[model samples]
Target: MKKDGQDMRQEGALKAADLEDAVRRADPDRALCARFLPASVRPDVEVLLAFHTELTRALAPARSAAIAGPMAGLIRLQWWRDVLEGARTPDHELAPPLLLALERGVLCRETLLRILAAREAELDPQPEVSAWRKMMLDGAGGLQRAVGEALGVRDAGVLARLEACGAAYGAGAMLRHWPRLQQSGRYLFPGDEAGLRGEGNAFLSACDTASLPSSARLAALPAILAERDLKRGSTQAGLPRGLGDRLAVMHAGWKATRVFQRSGAAAS
Candidate 1:
């Protein structure tokens, strides 16, 4: 079962490439992640983000689980086990950095176990309806706390903020994807779709309306606002008026609009 030396190196290079690509994709979140980090500790915070980025993708490919059935989505579970067990048949790209992270002996094993447990909710079909939310909350917190430790932040203030951001991001992601989970009655929270949809509708309603842009377009507009806004206005300057309306005109005129958000939001 042993592989050739050249093949091992090639596999390692591919994993590293994958990891780098994932990192680049998550770069958009820097504004949010950096907000809570102290000037001195932000570098470490950035490093920990690499961990979260990897975890997200680790779950993403499991989206194929929709047709594959919830239980069959256990591909990601095996991948995590494969990671922690150091069985690098695929040669984990993260292994080198994580090994270096462990050189200081700061990250806890319990932290990873919590991540595994939380992620298990997504895989397990038999979980009690009410147990899903608690599993996700606790599991997400565990991973964040683990990241905090690895980053060497001992101050109580910074720790709490990091954990808060972690919980918020984790909960938000699950909520964003709740509809699909609801379809299978496999929600991360313990509720049926009718109940879940009402709650989701209410929660989403609470988000700020001002986040929309280009112009003060309708809530359902497809403006690609962030990048478009940047092009129209400098980082030092605020957004222009009527940009949303203009973008709407552009899309509507050409009939070129596509889905604004991802599948979960599209389902909602």
Candidate 2:
């Protein structure tokens, strides 16, 4: 029995290490942010991020698929939905770690479905801007909500703020990836050229940074990174290279820590 238990423990550890490596490779920015999280909750956050990466990548082939047909992408998304709904285990390697995360309450079925739905919407050739915006907000907001839950944040108000932060983060991400979308003959913003020019600023302006709970701020740190990337004129071409990007991430972390400290002092 002891030997069996040891083998199981080793297997679990190896699985976790693989998940971490996957996250690091697929979503380096979020993986970097995950480094600042408390050890106990870090894996939970990493799993959520890894799940997001999986959903995002699953749609990559469809982005450049001929407009007349998107069946391939649709099928991929359906498979993810099936897995989340417990139709069957995922055939992909990423699914096992994600399943473990789900069992641990690091993720929930409703939020996972929301994320999948957002990916499905992207398959639309001419998705309504409003619908797309709503999907992005839902997907991003759900992620923050899950992170907040993992961090033991139960306040409805704080969760709502986190959702807003997530939306802002999503908007910034869309901007960052604008070049890639354009190159693929796909666009997400709602408007003419003039409107496109203003969209990034509009999203940044709408972020309600002040209302976020300090304890949950780490969940929204990506918003700060997004803002910095926008200010630096980063696009799908790439983010600011080297030291500049590193400093931006560090600054965002420092800001979150400072806010948390202030909130703690006020509570006392």
Candidate 3:
């Protein structure tokens, strides 16, 4: 290869490695993170993995903060965005992972912007479900389009596929959290365990059995649909071919909370 080509390849590889590492950090489930094997992904696909990690982490700080206090999650999101856009420089080494991932032609500039916008949406004191849905979709919807281009697709249709994923994933979130919303009078994001299950189980049932093929497992998983909500299974376990492992982790975390309650964590 020419020197220029070699340099480009090296840069791509570094970004890919950084993204994969970042995503693994974000997943919060060791078993699920391991599913992305060493050989299954191309270097360019790290964009999504990194995205998965960052977005998940952005929503989780307050809960993980281990102190009962005001919501600090959005503060953390702004803190990182400030660092990434050079508004502030973080002291931690994880500071530049997303910025480094940006150089690989993995996404347009708006990807991170949209993610921050979504975080802001999440930070609202109160949010309507419809509005929150739009915010969530915006963050991830463009990624497939961006990745299609980077992966050499001349005209790969991204909107339709990502819309499908967003709808399914979003429905799963609402269905999973319907009961919680009814009780708390607040719209919740991921990483809130008790809050999610307190919502109506009926809505989840409706969402699960809804006519959409993408989310048919909202109630009865049977392995295919269980893939999105649970992280323990392998590809051989028969989930559909296209779902992101992060969705699977989300599903698993919800279910684990149920199990923990049954075992008396919440009650205790």
Best by the TM-score measure: 2
Model 2: CA > 4 A from native? 1-14, 125-127, 192-206, 234-236, 239-242, 255-268
> Could you tell me how far off, in angstroms, the CA of residue 143 lies in candidate 3 after the best superposition?
5.4
lDDT of 3 by residue, 18-57 (tens): 4445544443233242333123233434545454445445
Error of 3 at 115 (Å): 1.6
Model 1 TM-score (2 dp): 0.49
lDDT of 1 by residue, 1-268 (tens): 0122111123333343343334445633332333333344443334444554455445544555556664444565666557665664535544455544545555554556566666666655345744654554346545555655654545554444434334444444444445454453443556543444343333233322234221112211112232233233223232223545354435542321122223225557
- Those runs of model 1 whose alpha carbons end farther than 4 Å from true positions after fitting are 1-21, 24-27, 34-53, 58-75, 85-90, 125-130, 153-165, 176-186, 192-268
**In candidate 2, what are the lDDT values of residues 130-187, reduced to their tens digit?**
7756665667767776777777777877766666566666666656666665676544
- TM-scores for all candidates: the values are 0.49, 0.79, 0.48
Candidate 1, residue 111: the lDDT equals 57
**Pairs that clash in candidate 2:** none
lDDT of 2 at 254: 80
lDDT value for candidate 2? 0.66
